[model samples]
Target: MSSADQSHPSGNKPLGKRARQKIERPRAILAAALDEFMLKGFWAARVEDIAAKVGITKGTVYFYFDTKEKLFAETIRSFSPNLASESEPIDKNRPVREQLTTYLAVLYEAVAINPDAKRVFHLLISEGRHFPELLDQYFAEFLAPALDRITSLITSGIERGELKSTGLASSPEVLIGPAIVANLWGIVFADRHPRDIDAILTTSLDLFFRGLLE
Candidate 1:
């Protein structure tokens, strides 16, 4: 029988016993795999290791993901929501600074809560030489949409005269890029020092607002 044909003690919920098992197995595997991958990294992480971590056989791991590359790709995809969700649309009628502040706060909270996920993300970015396709998928699926939304916000701010009439088309990058870099640096290097995140965000917004004011 296929893996989906197996039975589980978990109650039925539209999926057959085997299908539910199949659905749940990968989630369990991915949860364990993420922990292992974050601890050991993509190149060093082995399917056997992940299988042991998830109490499954190596063949079972392959059945779910087909390859280590696919597993890592999925792992990276998982981290992305933490970052991408920060860019959800804000009320356009809200004050520009308030909207920007909310965006930065969401980004900060996501990183703060998911440090391991962030570390895995950084590793992917730094060591993705052989996996350009994976990196491309990450950017296309997560980062690009977030950036587009931010850019749209900036454009709207300009059009509404809430921002300066500067010819800067990539205003979102100008506003957000430095903050992202700072957050990454702080997380990776600051030894978990008490950063006044509110102060930093306020200062950044102030600076951006000053530049954009008439």
Candidate 2:
């Protein structure tokens, strides 16, 4: 058999066009939904409009996600980081200051620098009251775990005499609040208030670590 024709390594054939389309249909729908949600808040967004963007019928969009609310939730989920899994594994041997700087850099990049994530944040702020369960899901699924990780990292640093034992360790949300604020600034001000996220992160970390380091 020709090398190109032989695909029996895993005893599975390449997916057919129809199969690939079926797999990708949901992702296309979700992307279109996010754009629609961003352009028009949740109340104004229409499933038909999202489906039109995806070149699919409204019923087809419904086939994958039954309701507009489910579609919006899933769209945010698709774009959001799986914080628990995505967090960089801390190197305990490294100085806590270095560890924190590296970790916070990643957090800031994800929350402040990413435009799509910022859009999702804006949507949540503006439209989340309409979907209380969606807000709860975001907190329970993403925010809670991320805060827990920060708290554990701080506690470890304190025990190792690397970080100061302060109220900040107990409330680790403060560590990431500035990143969220920067994200909000982007959403509210757009290009009018141009601030470099890298500079913001560097300065914020420097100030924060000065207070945190033992």
Candidate 3:
């Protein structure tokens, strides 16, 4: 093993028996594609540019992803967390409100810190009007899972009498509504009037729980 590869963060030492570069090439391609797609909207992004970014040929890019649209979709999907798995930290043993606060804190931290993923979300909102397929995939992969988890939490809270009987009981969007607004806030004011994300999230959840809690 080379000295540089010995201390890799992933904890995997160099293996002389296998060609890991072959496995890394697709990841490199996707990384390159994300940069290109974010810089030049999906429609304007070319497979040639993505391939060129990674020093690969356009045909090689197509070998991994059949088309530019699929590449764009996969690039965005790659950055999104699996909300189902993310929500696994929820503790049924704890107070429901406390469980919810911890959940939102983790979720908001993830959304606020990942600027590249936020940009991809902006791409989804802007381009989704024209590309229904991307919209469908995004909803199925990210949105539905998040909503389902939120619904489960809210349902539990209602059953335990920790929360009021309201729309948040049926539609948990009320809980995450600020996250959507915060994404827009970052998109517009991130350069000029950036707010402390932690402060914003704390205050939003504080207010959210106060209004919902019985």
Prediction-by-prediction clash tally: 1, 0, 0
Residues 1-214 of candidate 3 have per-residue lDDT tens digits of: 5533643346675634235555677889888877887778878888998899899899998998898877877787787655665757557688888777777766665455567667777778877787788778878877777777777787888888888766776777777777777887888798999887667777889887778874
| Candidate with best lDDT | 2
Which ranges in model 2 have alpha carbons more than 4 Å from their true place? 1-11, 86-90
Candidate topping TM-score: 2
Q: Model 1 off-target regions past 4 Å?
A: 1-20, 82-92, 108-113, 190-199
lDDT against true structure, model 2: 0.80
lDDT of 2 by residue, 159-210 (tens): 8988888898888888888898888888778679878777777888888888
Measured against the true structure, the TM-scores of the candidates, in listed sequence, are: 0.74, 0.88, 0.82
Report the alpha-carbon TM-score of model 3 versus the true structure: 0.82
Candidate 3: worst-modelled 10 consecutive residues by lDDT: 1-10
